[model samples]
Target: MHFQEESIDCVDFVLRKDEVLTVILGGGKGTRLLPLTEKRSKPAVSFGGKYRLIDIPISNSLNSGFEKIFVLTQFNSYSLNRHVHRTYASNAVHQKSFIEIIAAEQTVSSVRWFEGTADAVRKVLPYIREQRPKYVLILSGDQLYNMDLADFMQNHLIDPETEISLACNAVPEDQVYGLGIVKTGIGDSIKEFIEKPQDLEQVESCRQTSGQFLANMGIYIFNTKTLIEVLEDQSLTDFGKEILPKAIQEKKVKAYVYDGYWEDIGTIRAFYEANLMLTDDIPKFNLYLEKTPFYTRARSLPPTKINNAIVNKALISEGTILNHCEIHRSVVGVRQFIDHGTKIYDSIIMGLNRYGSLDRQSGKIPHGIGKNCEIRNAIVDKDCAIGEGVKLLNLKNVTEFEDEFVRIREGIIVVPRHTTIPDGYEI
Candidate 1:
């Protein structure tokens, strides 16, 4: 089914913004990302050289007029909480439009943390129930895509019989076991949902006549009452693993098929590849759309300055100073300092916050990339200290590596936050 630009009138005819509550789940430890999530939560991890992963979903909600949003966070959430509070301001004019964080907390009855995505929402339902929202939209935090949620919600509002609406996409059949697979029956209804189905028949059930398999996008809009009933069952932890499959059998589930540029940054390699795509001549997912712009924490920084640098296909963010460097197909974040004779290719350097002192005598912190370094197919995280002449080529062609300062996954080197690579070091 085609998803045209939905009308505001149609959205208003169905439900008001206040009647629907948007919940963003961003508490994952992001183990696959490793050092990137070493100090921050998954959602707080920087993306596209400027914004955080959480910004994608939040921006989609606000741009689509779903303003009453709540982000559920845990596992090193200090950075995420700070970013949310600083960047997203509450709408005093409307009063109902607010972006708030609900971190996993300890209660008298239970001191345990949130077990899974569904469990995270289940524990927070009591507070959400007070809002009296008709529907609850649940979203994954670390996904990169642009979605007009109005279109997704309108499908459910127009079809009152659908108690649960999910955003699904057609994926390759080989990936059926890696994602939540949906089987659509009559009228686009989800007849069955197989979460990471291992059985051969169950995988075959997800295949469509068009030679594609239906993969769940982990985006769900649920009837408030039905959600409450489902969450009341304490055994159901993950939405994809437990709740969704059972919901298809008991409740009316509908699929809003989305055919767009959506990337789940599940691994370091995926994150690196997605970011590098922005440097291409024609990016699959353009971030410069004025109609639905992405939101992020704005920094009071100056424009990037390049002095005689041979740069090509790069996204250079503000407050970076590169001098006589050769960069190709890379993303340079804010406040980065790259000296002369350095070559960067297919890499992501998460810029620093402040300029570091080269001299140790003044007791100033040391950071940023030093001179004459060679970095390729790597992810240089924020505040990393890359010494001069250091080479990060993944020389051994290793898929995974574990070290004190650097880690490699799928041949992508990840320099953790605040790591100081000694001069002349090689990886």
Candidate 2:
């Protein structure tokens, strides 16, 4: 079936007639997105209320007309695994199109898990090479943005002689130190490359080469032969350290400058800020566009209902019922029930399951927050039951609060799943 192309900027590029395989690097222990990432892997972390981090990349791949994707994970892959299975179930129409979540356990050679970004791919080297695709697309599963990768790949394949193509973007000097910075040489060929500089001087020197420094987008396209040769070399393991630099030295590396809405959701603040971007009046990243549509496990639920209440800049997922609640710049996940007389601002309320009445209710679920409650600047995980009159206040004056059930991380309150907090408790 043909997908919509509204969101993506159409590029003029012709792709080769060959089967393509995509490998998504998703195993990194997202210590940065802490608390929220404390339970699942980075890619599994919920974003924009209903979608996970993996959905961004996976959706992009499918929308771009490439299939047979593999998600490589090491740390906390349970949620990631379940999501791919349930969301992207096997399809007979696109028999060749499939999204597989392959963990470190599925590595061909050793039983030990993936070590680094390059090591992760190295472990799965054999499996991917066996696919025999003309080109390989490498992507990171923890970023936020939308791009037409087909355009990038088309540029890469322009010269059939070229081996490695890297999608690059300009990042701030302070942030470019940890990533691979390239100095474009002759004909878009990279001349210099650095992997995570140790000092400010090195960063400055690297920045001087290009007026606008180019940082790797954590996305790559490699010729099947080039990948086989690089992976076969026992001396070379990591991409940033061994393969990429060597390819640059050999004058085989090419760079594609990408000026789009791409962000690395590396920390809790960054993650929250990125989510907040979706609520922008004119968001940097628009999911409503017909083209470049972001695909997700479609929840066959009814549309949302706003009852006489004013909601400004909020993302309400399908199957959610909001009644007389004022929500501003927040995200409400699937099947959630926002009762009347509740005000939520700058927060995220995940999936709320309505089971049988516990200490008894009139058939309504006590799983989520109750009426007359006010939540501000917080993230409530799935299946949490917040009683009436509860206030999760993140005011400037209040630095920290001691609550047994609630977890406060860096001043951000996190209410875990199935947690029951008494009414009138101020967190």
Give the per-residue lDDT digits (tens) of candidate 1, residues 1-427.
0112253565483365768899999868888788788789888999988999999999888777788888999899999999999898775776766888998999986688999999999989987898999999999989988998988988887788889999998888776777899889888999988888886587785688898988999999999999998988898899999999898889999999999988888888789899999998889878888888898888899888999999999999999999899999999999999988999999999999787676645544358787899999999998887878889999999988888768888888889888888888998
lDDT per model vs. reference: 0.87, 0.76
Residue pair clashes in candidate 1: none
Candidate 1 ranges with C-alpha deviation above 4 Å:
1-7, 10-14, 358-365
Lowest summed lDDT across 10 adjacent residues in model 2 is found at: 8-17
Q: Each model's RMSD to truth, in Å?
A: 3.2, 3.4
**TM-score, per-candidate, Cα-based:** 0.95, 0.89
RMSD (CA, angstroms), candidate 1: 3.2
Clashing pairs in 2: 4-291, 5-290, 5-291, 5-292, 6-290, 6-291, 7-291, 367-385
Model 2, CA-based lDDT? 0.76
Candidate 2: residue 40 lDDT (0-100): 89
lDDT of 1 at 270: 82
Stretches of candidate 2 off by over 4 Å are 1-17, 106-108, 208-211, 233-237, 353-365, 396-403
